[model samples]
Target: MAATSRDVAREAGVSQATVSRVLTAGTPVSEKTRARVMDAMARIGYVPNRAARTMKTGRTGTIGVVVADLGNPFYPQLLEALSRSLDASDHRMTVWVSDGGKNQAALDAIREGTVDGVIFTTVTEHSHELARALEQRSPLVLVNRTVEGADCDQVSSANRQGAGLIANYLVAHGRTRIAFIGGTPLASTTAQRLGGFSDRLARLGHPLPDELVAHGAYTHESGCRTAAQLLHLNPGINALVCSNDLLAFAALDTAKAAGIRVPEDLWVIGYDDIQQSSWRSLNLTTVRQDVAQLAAEATRLLLARLDDPDRPAIRVELEPTLVVRASSAFAPA
Candidate 1:
């Protein structure tokens, strides 16, 4: 039979209630008694039942992470950083994946009190039910996506600034006829990037031709289709800015198939400088978001909320830097 709290109490010559109290540390216990309980637990190899402890304390010591599309390469790196940061604070993470924007399972998990806090990414503004559920259950932190009119802690990169960087780079390289590829119209990140890109282009006395911008879901197929659409609409376009590296890769492949010479004939740029961006074949020029820093900050924000739920919510926006590569033309000397 496994060692139980009763065995620990018997070995320590204390009541089971005392053992439980010492283990939880919910209330102050004498140092001598705590030491005695620790020794007894060590000697007996007694492991407390986490579920029972949670029942008593109403805290799981676990943070729930809800992500949309775990398949995205960027999310895995972000998850790794979040896990490391939470581990340092002695908190465990329970990851949940939502299909696209459907967060029914995630909402259920949160409502059932399975975790003390939640860090979510890829939520849409239309996620009313999920948002309401989170508001009722536990402290919530938004990562990489923000819900409109929702009051919560949010950590995200400056998408607008990053997109503007790409636009400026394209313009400076004398690519006046540029096109935008990738991103679902409903996605906030996509909207921000598009807005910034258009605003910057207008400032430079060059407006994005209405037919040149293409909106599609973030997928390789979408990238290919969008690229084809842009080219068919405006063969004069010499540059394309993708919403993400995946889309950028797809654009590269499509450009190759269409016999478009990269940098010499057409330039491509992407966002979120994913690891695959540096691959020998791709070498994509992109906006580098500090995934590690964003994840760490989100974890810290969620943990702080768990420590004090009454604290005011905060929004942390990290700046992104542009990484020039072979895909884009080099600046004039």
Candidate 2:
């Protein structure tokens, strides 16, 4: 026979209402009472009926996380952070991987009433799909990306400032004829990074030429292909700034295959500073955005929004710092 809340309360010598309060986190109970109730639950093998609780509270206690590419190491890092933060709040995460914010799966997930809110980790700039999500009246927060005119809460790193830092580092180190490898142009992260890097270079009197700028899909293969083309077809690209660490890793290998000495013959830098960037073989110098902090902030914003749906949309941007490594050492004059 399944143990009910009544059974738990009886075993713990507490009223049914007291058990309800403890389970729902409604009010603070003394530690001793909490321990007694918990022990009773364990001994009786009591499992709260989540469906009944949802019916009462009108909240699923689950948050939907929409990611563009699970393959990108950056998204997984953000997901891990979000999961941990949400878990602390007694909320579980349900992940939905969309194809560049253009898939029916995300809308279906929302419509299914499976989650109380959503966290878009890959919201594209000027995304209609995100607009639809906003219209759906789902309490959602954008993480690491945002639409230009969307009325939604956002948490992200200072992409422009971080990219500018890399540009300055490359230029100050005497690397001329620099090139850029970008990910999805529609992504806010890509736009900000490309804009910042190019704008800063222009201000430094080294405007990037069209030939030196290439686009990729934020994949290693795309990075390898673009890098090979840039090195073989173009001329005198002394430095390459990739949009993310995965691309940078591919560029590193491609550069080596082409017999181009990194940092000595060519400098490379990337964003996100993923784990692979620190591996002994790569040693990639990249921009380090505090993904865990970003996720935590995003979770907080979403919960707050859920509490007060009419709250004004907030945009939180954390500062990003550069992590230097062997891939971007100062070039010799």
Candidate 3:
């Protein structure tokens, strides 16, 4: 039989109320009492029943994270960081994959009582249903994307600034005929980054040709296809600004297959500075979105709202920095 709270309290020589306060309320119990309770729990192998606790507190103590395309390397890193941060706060994460579609199934998961709150990524223009469903019951935090006319908390990177940095670097290196490999245009991240890049390029007097701008689905295959189209439309394009690392890597692969020398013949840049970007084979220059900070901040925001559902919505945007690497390096003129 599993040990109960009563047994733990008895063994710890403290009242059950004190133990509950120490664990749930985070009330500072004396070190002696805390040690005793911890020792008792260890000896008896006591595990608090989360379901029972939820029934008592009316909170699931779990957060739902909805992301688009788990296959994208950037999201996996962000998810891992978020899970770690939530665990440190004594909360668990339940992940839901939104397969690049604004479907009823995803909205239903948010509407039904599956978790306390939700962190949404990859929201598209068609994500109004999700916005409506989330607004009805639980606190919703938009991660990396936001819907127009939606009232919710948001956590995202400064994509526009990061995109500008990449554009400036490319232009400084005298790469005038630049092209953009944008991801799903509906995604806020993609839209902002592309807008920034285009705006900066136009300001710098090296505007991108309409034919040189290509959109993809944020997948490697889509990146490859988009790169092919961009190359076909503007074969003399000197630089490519991909919206994310995965797409950038695909662009690099496509360039290599087409016998184009990276940096020497074509400068390729990516965003989101994923782990693999620094690998020896793919030293990708990209924009870095502080994943750890984003995750920890988002977790903090969600937990705060979970604790107080009536809290005003907040939007936190972290600045992204440019990381220079071999992928975008220019040779001496």
> Runs in model 2 with CA error above 4 Å?
6-43, 100-104
Which candidate order results from sorting by TM-score in descending order? 1, 2, 3
Candidate 2 lDDT over residue span 193-268, tens digit each? 9999999999998899988888888888999999999988765888999988888988999999999999888888
Candidates 1 and 3 compared: the better one by TM-score is 1
What's the CA RMSD for each of the models? 2.2, 2.8, 3.0
lDDT of 3: 0.83
Best lDDT among the predictions, by candidate number:
2
TM-score for candidate 1: 0.92
Candidate 3's displacement at residue 103, Å, is: 7.8
Off by over 4 Å in 3: 6-43, 100-113
Q: What's the best-to-worst order under lDDT?
A: 2, 1, 3
**Could you tell me the lDDT of residue 203 within candidate 1?**
93
Output the better candidate (2/3) by TM-score: 2
Candidate 1 minimal-lDDT segment of 10 residues: 100-109
Give the whole-model CA lDDT for all candidates, comma-separated: 0.83, 0.86, 0.83
Model 3 lDDT per residue over 192-221, tens place = 899999999999998877888899888899
Q: How high is the lDDT of residue 96 in model 3?
A: 74
